[model samples]
Target: MGRNTRKRRTPLAAKVVAGAAALAVGGGGLVWANFHASAHEEGPAHHRTRSAAAQVATIDCPDVGQQLSGVPDRARGEVDGELATMDSQITEAYQRLATTRRAQAGDPRFVQNTILGPLKDRRKAIIDRIQLEIDRAGGRADDNLDQLAGCQGRPAEQPQNGDGQDGGGQDGDQNQDDNGNGAAGPVADDFIDINDVQPNSRASENGLAANGDGGSTGTFTTDCGVNENNLFNSDNLIAAPGVDNGAHHVHDYVGNQDNDAFSSDEDLANADTSCRNQGDRSTYYWPVLRLQDGTEEFDANELGGGAEGNVGRILKPAQAELKFVGNQQGDVVAMPKFLRIITGDAKSFTNGDANANSSWSCTGFEDRQVTDKYPLCPEGSQVVRTSNFQSCWDGQNIDSANHRDHMAFVQEDGGCPNGFQAIPQLQVRLVYDIPTPTVENGQVRNPYAVDSFPEQLHKPITDHNDFINVMDEDLMNEVVDCINSGEDCQ
Candidate 1:
């Protein structure tokens, strides 16, 4: 029990520490192992300049093994079902390859590619295959849960059974069922299937309006009106809810091409359209995810969860990503990137934090013209996937919501009454994601396991379960609380 409690808290605790004051240190210890360090400083030559960790602190390297202990609450039985389905898909692909080989059994042309051919070129396919195990130790529905006869089931016969809900004779893990109230009997993880809640989990740790992890069931409210359509399947909340309160953020622009959801056929079929962007170009898409979808309940995450149905549903990514839209302007082709800015006392800029480039002084906090913020911008520093920032905020209060995170010049475009800018300065950061109570190679010998249970299920990512010794509150808070606050960063 003591161990389980510690394990449960470890991931989140690490998150807190990560957000508060994580910095890249010079020497090696536990900190050096996990965090990727950078020695970059913001400068005046926008081209030769760099982006530093600023305004609010951020961590790109994540240690979520602890927090990922349980199954996602969104789709309890979907794990088993999902795994089963994935196996089938893999089988289908294999069959296709096999058929291709049979047709050209002897022809050298048939030997067009080698064994790793399909896999090597299809990074997307390969990534999709292992995405679940990599991101949060989370898996999507293999669809065998409720499959009928002749239909296959999970290959491991595992995946979603961690919670015991599938009744595969697995151990029951839920102390409380999906509703937050105690269940009449023992339960397993995956009791609920909302993406917001960890898979295989029966309890609720994050604050949500309703339990369901915002399932496809209930009547959720949005300024747009009653969302009976169950957009993201958020049981109680409406899709794009709270947009009126400024909770609305640009997730992604969907267009006919990659961003197909943005403009309709009308936008693409214009007669006198000569100049413009992708949509203006009339060949691709430019849709963006609203802030609601970007955070809280992203459609596409490492685990391959989020979003329901097979329609042309727009998915919100779990992490904020770097989008490179090929653009053709007056005479050149370019990609647009929203750069991070600085926010510290006179700018001694902190190191680009959490393996991400940082910024300071809120310099470029409000600017529409980004032509000059380019050139070396991509290589000047590093890139950070910010989808986490969406969930970090308190929503009700923009000024204070997840205020600990350094706001980007893009998010804080105008409102720079407090003084912000991009300047030349050095950015320092603590090593990212070093476990609290850092672990050593031989600390516990086989310290990776939480107990016999989890290890048997899967090999632990870190040294040991529930063994974060370096997690001191003050130190952790300092890291999280420090990013982008415009204070003394270094």
Candidate 2:
């Protein structure tokens, strides 16, 4: 009696016709009064009818790998072929607005007057012609496109009444519910139609191989770049004002002065780095895997609204690994500079928890399947995700109480427990080239999505990560003398 406490049935004419199209779409008059005040109330089912204009708007652009390293070289092939057609129209507008249906997901002003205001005015005229071809090849135009074509407009609900709760309370057949609680009604789609699920054929048993027993003793790399910073805005700084303050969704930071959250510890040991070792200012972060394209352009501050917090756009990760797995008798140490760790489970997309350890694979596919359901990657190969952390810690908490009780998860031939201590086992790896979700007859249609929070839809295994060791005590003793001299430094 828990999966949100069963009991279903209620579409109330798709929530009174999506609350009368959000009061005929005029700033959704408080989503037509919270959809008739939760339309007859009920409990649990992870309750959520909160509306502040139904909360959506999220924009974060400008990190197409740091704008292709400031493009120069005579406009690097027309700014990499116009950022490959703007990442294929931002992954086909988030797969047509997350499969829109629920009685036309109540007007967020008709998805901002027809799809993200014309893809944010055609991505601000293609970042103003790639910032005039990177300022005529002199570079440094820093094309942020006015903070990635700022956006705003929410108000879209009514589609979650299969006892999964969320459909203006209950009342009879849009599907079923005679009270036995079998639940199965409002199907006019609300989201999560990653092509009716099933693709993860199961294969990757943690591929990335190379633990090679012998109790590993080397590896301490750190490239941490491209994911500049935009911790879902909430006033930029880390988890502002405390207790995971503003991170409603959207992440993509990287090391040290992680672009604010009051960075300290001497401001991340005097920050400044994209790490090829400028003394490894360790910070690292996650989230932000858009391509859902229903116009929330990877949202940031629409429902939470501004204060300079919800900045978006920041992709780049065709390849990124920041290894650190030591101790074969090496006794690695020195990671306390403001340490704060977290890994996987970002609400596992509303606690459905499909075996969440945060992973999704596809490179030439062999079927990986670990949950957040993913597949469709054939042509050339793409779509990857991996978030592995927890290197033992607990020599006096840097964070715990469910931020993962002081960390621990190493032994499976990887070692490091028995009163936890060995740090340096963080892995991130994300790559998404895009395109490959078109099957049709047997149903596949993907359009890559994963920048959640439209009532938490785009799952992709809720991949999560967040570290902050800001190395440098002689570069953390040169990563503990290159992992106790076993030597495999990158």
Candidate 3:
């Protein structure tokens, strides 16, 4: 594959040279005096100036050359190899910083303290480690340390001219900046937007009154056992034996002791469950919601530098409904083992299309919906979010290309589509006691969001659920009987 390289723009040489000259002179004039005085007095002055310019040109900020110069000869090769990878690392860091800065544009302190501060610290630590290695090798630190340090103090430069065009030209050609680089495009307008999202129309205008007594058949419920296996905690199930936390985030698991990415029909059939019913060993789970209480438990992975380690508390759903939505005759059947079910779109939270099925509300104020914004729970109330997964499954396939093709939402009338058999629907609800934001020290702070989940995740409404049906035949029969009898059994 061909590598895509951006066109290198040489900075104005005079400006760069002048800046270096000023820095050199200010730092005790050791190298500056030698170069300046020699240039003025010697016939080869022009040549020396050219040499100095070349040297200055080589000094890229976070200068790898200077960093590697202090390493022992034997270790230099390995050090150089590692430094080569830093460019991509730095690039990735800039991308994340850009996303965070855009997302938290309203909260300057959050951008500065949470995002930029940690990034700067990490960069400095890297440089310091290199300096330490150089010192151990008995080499002096780079003479350009002052200049390099200055670079660290400044923010990463934003391209002034993109694609060699002005951003606000008469033609309204706004895609590129003056330098011909692509523009960042518009911000997302989703619930995560923090500024734009409003209450769901269906939920806000016509209160989400509970479904009353209609279509009550073929519905069964179970109180799955809840566990404390978080995404960051090591107790969570591994996707595969050798991969560590391959699932990325944490989930609360229930049923099927052998549930994992590699589990087979036999494994699921033989495994025990955490549910109240031993025969119903289906595996159901969702990401763990953390309470952001300034504690280590909710602390995001600021030091690790990734989106997976978010810090925040989980909120419970105001209402949750679980049922099988097909086979009107009330004949409930066992779901196939290894069946993968996913609910609530993770991408929708930030993509401007928050799912209507996913809902957010306060405990005592269930009639009011607050999917777009975090609600301020009352003194004794709490916040909750709900996720409802599709229940109609394609009997022939256990999985699909998108992890969703094999299963689908029920029809508007609550019936399964032809060819898609009805399976037990899983509904998940989360609860949180955290309060709303309060002005602390002149800044808007979310009391509930002490330590939060990843900033990329946007908010708690992005909640999703996954399940793998692994119930025994008798258990499946019992579930069917419970649903067919038109009784709400938990």
Candidate 4:
């Protein structure tokens, strides 16, 4: 059977529990819901229970990388390195916060005074170095960057019983573990039964209206085995080139085999590809999914794994579908070689949902999708993650200082913004066969979560995908021609 076409489970009478107070997060922000009846599962292995009282949730800080613009090419590498260092600093602080519950209970200001204060100082120093790098390269740096160094603690979910006490019930340094075991995240509250979600309508083609003869309605599918070659890494060359473990979590790579922190354009163009079509050497990657079931994977003791709070048995996708579709308004242009695109915000848990584009659902229930919460699929169903990349290019630069300004999502009318050209949009769909997590006593056991920055708490909202177009000029032209001619070519 195809991965997306899984057998459907027999329909059981919906189980609705009354008088349950749950933590619900929406596109705007966090919302607390006291519902008279909510949907849940009805089996011994799957029970929807209240989430544990929020632990030391996450650290919230301004995104310095998003604030930078107009950086000179000469200083980009050094500035990127400094940004990666800042990310590491936050990870270290979060690790300390996760393990210091006793100190937190003893002093209300312990996190502020001990963690945030010192973190801010370190970040300020790093920010100054970034400014110096830019200034030395004959470019002007933002003088107000130091103001973004300070961070604050965001409280986790409150207890549903109105007890106003921290959950986990630990004392004297026996704090919560970093993995999916209560402290780090993917708590019971982070999941919702997929059947409970109402079917919501979305744009027919992710905002691309493929009507009228003027639009490009074709698609090009590439068969790249889902990381079967085991190309996994913790580096993100686009965001933090030349820095090791820049992603802070392991990613599953599919296309380019030579991708790493130090890969150059020439290296990627000449590298081997997992794609069946050797002409298509583009790289497609995203954070790996893991079952927090205490099973140690190969990276269990590595920096981006157990040591960095991302412990669990990694789960490979049963299917990774990569397809490039055409523009809805006009014929799509060939993407410049080595064009880099990031689809979603990797820090949406703390950065809010402005750039969040996570779409999660079950094999049988594709009509309903969730952004912030992990879906608890019923028996016989599999989990699915979908990402649609921005398709409008600036027609000049392959990348931008902030890594996002060079591309834009299609406008509501399916037209590119001024000075931008329409390019083929990439849509990635990954399917996984994970066991449903059991929730009891306000805690999650064997919960599956996406790898994320430690401070992001492995929230589903932080799920994202990355792509670097490495197709040779001939293959790209063929893709454009196939798309414009309205033919589904593979």
Candidate 5:
């Protein structure tokens, strides 16, 4: 006499975040793939909590009595302004892409960050960085954008209340005495959109393009005269080799997948799976920043003294776990805060994996609710788990069944209680700013713009067919000379 009950699984990005402790054990970037452990493996809720790791890395949360830097109003203004500018830049890039082949809509020459990373990551980073700078200058002592723009030495604001309180202005009686001056924390070198672009990242040099500006990592083409149905008619597989041999896919998007019948047939099936994985499912995770003196106050800031040392909570590690979801080795699963399930470095550019930094897709087996109360989270930015289903634990039994509670969030909790959903473009820019690891190297890379790219396009921009793979300088020069001499060409 047993009842038939079925509970859905959670995604890997939704899994508990792995802290520095786990990282110390030589664990790669967090993922619930076969490469990583599952929630049920054997650890307790607090097993791999990140607080200790954050502390060890000198990335501590702001405690009481600590002063925040930068002026809130100024920081907001700067971030908003930068976003507006980036929005325009992103648009311009898209327009350029449009002029290319229809298949080029997804071209890296046009954009990757805009398409790959979520829009919010870019937007938030810009504003946050600006605010960080404003805070560093004692909240109102900033010199210029140059000093402000650099992502280094940013602290929260320190207010001197009258009667010699903090933020009590220059040379105040009691205010000057309590202020413990320390150099601002170091800022990330640049902004990067993890989605479509990799930016200023070591990953980019390995073959990933920081953005469309750098170059294409790969390319996909759309054959003319093909609707969703006739996609594989050789004529339909855009620049396909030899008639596409009657190849096609369910969803037009076949990442750098090969053009073959099985690939085509399996594509639709996989696409169906990808979309199925997201049905009525949304992720919840908070992007917390250390509030400090002079730091900009927003949603979390209103709570009072939440800013950090000119540094706001920048890296939001919360994302879904890929294992619980149906994502597979090659497919991608999107998680809130720009977290996605990706394979390890095994798939490098050298191996034809463009974003050699980290393979972009997560393993498909371990999808479970990262938190029991994920169902209670509202749909919007700053989505945090609603329960105590904490971080990863090794050698423990993670009951994936607990995730059933998350479905309730889809019905309740509410969507963006702020009811604020930026147009696709703005959403992309805002998220990349700060408290979100927006900087890749030392530049800005937006992801929202990709929505503007026609869905017809596939793949990235880079072309490596017969590319010279020589390591020696003189040998490379000789090879280039031979090619230039036209022996091969002739």
Candidate 6:
């Protein structure tokens, strides 16, 4: 890995303690910095100059795939392929957006006329194709699909000067600013000190009285090694089946070895397992974390890597804990084989946070988590990322047209809603031993970020996890029995 030869500042611990009071924690334990009140007052003059002149940061487009539903089974493959094409179109438009900053500066409507217009046209064509696939397969296409073709250019969010370390709070170099290093995102404002975040309770942990007696209190743990095999790919079988580079960013895969874009249920069932238990062949995967210290990974020039703005040294997790917890109301039923569940929204950056479920924190500051901002852990503390999957199943469908209508999270009162059945919740907790990022001269060096879609700019809010329940019926029953008996088992 290559790092810039810059003088380091005082230890991060001291700065964290200094700025502990000014920051406030938000949902899922990630802290959201109050830009005006928290941005350090003594940042360089360039920070203020850059904030005053905002530029187009990224392209924001409505997720067309999320809008369509009830596609026939026969058309799913074609519809998914078209949706993947739409993603590639967005990525291409974003790359142009990043490189055409000069052209944008010269013409006020350059983005609208040259970039967004063509992108919208391409997207409209893809959407039309998707509609044809659905209608041709004897399914009614949604009438509003054409409305989702348009996209808007979003100005870079300004980072306010704040009261902490050099990197803690400053101008948002979220655009093509020199400080941003052309990465399009993960500016100084994207991170906050873990010490500054206040401890917040998770919604799942509160108000369980409606569910009665914490049913199925036992847990089933699986010992799956932390992807030592280095199984990495950009394929998302659940979302864009049969489409290569569907994810746009690489994912760290564990469990089923045969999992990929072209993987069929039969292929997955016959795949080798990474779990200690032979019966559990489920596939579990999430985006790989990377340190942006100018290191050239093997995929540096690949579609899901540097070409898509996911440049960095991929960091293997020190610990990857996968556990199945019980529901609050009652014993969980066995999840059907080949059941696919996507926990968080991968395009939450442009799509909005309605379906965001990512959580980031530090080892010592576990109580204080942040949903949107990455945590800057103090010295000796490690970084942590967690995804709590949906625990309620529809009891009929193993998958759905939109991939989310088949499962859901528990309600505020801790019970499954309506007809949804309680199912074992898959909880993934990943910990990393990363070097603390240092800020010098108002630029963040060696910043760590999760791989994301090119247009997302590596926002932590877009972090997500994928799961496929390939466990045999016997193993699933054992898991349910273990939970119902209130005994933890591996």
Residues 1-490 of candidate 5: C-alpha lDDT, one tens digit per residue: 0111122222111121112112211111111010111112123433333221111111111111012223343242233233333332222222222122122222322122332233234334554565465666446523333322211111112111331112211111111211211101121211112332322223222222111221111111111111122221111121111121111111122112232222332232233211122221111111222212222323122111111111222222233221111111111111221111111111111123322221121112111112101111112333221111111111111111111111111111211113221000000000211222223432212111100011101111111110001112342233233322322210
lDDT tens digits, residues 349-381, model 3? Answer: 223333325566666665555444455565677
lDDT pick, better of 1 and 4: 4
lDDT of 6 by residue, 1-490 (tens): 0111122222222233224312211111111121221112234554333422233556789988777778887787777777777787777666656544445545667778988999899888888888888999999998789999999865544432332112221222222232434354566767888877878744543211222357888888998899988899988888878777778889999899987887878888889989999999999999999888767788765667766667778999999999888877787888988888998899887787778886899998888888778899988999999888888899998887888988888887678989999988888889999998876655666789899987787788889999999899999999999988888999
Per-residue lDDT of candidate 1, residues 95-174 (tens digit): 22222322323333332243223423332342344335333444452323221112111111111213122211012222
Model 5: lDDT equals: 0.20
TM-score of each: 0.18, 0.35, 0.52, 0.85, 0.18, 0.84
Q: Which ten residues in a row are the worst by lDDT in model 5?
A: 421-430
Candidate 4 or 1, higher TM-score: 4
Give candidate 4's TM-score.
0.85
TM-score for predicted model 2 compared with the true structure: 0.35
List clash counts for every candidate, in order.
116, 23, 34, 0, 139, 14
Error of 3 at 396 (Å): 1.7
The reply for model 3, stretches above 4 Å from the true place, is 1-218, 228-243, 257-266, 298-308, 312-333, 350-356, 439-455
lDDT of all predictions: 0.19, 0.46, 0.41, 0.73, 0.20, 0.73
Selected candidate, larger lDDT, 2 vs 4? 4
Residue 461's lDDT within candidate 6 is 82
lDDT tens digits, residue span 354-449, model 2: 325656666644245344555555667777777666667878766432245566666655566788777666667667776654433222232444
Task: Tell me the lDDT of candidate 2.
Answer: 0.46
Error of 4 at 454 (Å): 0.6
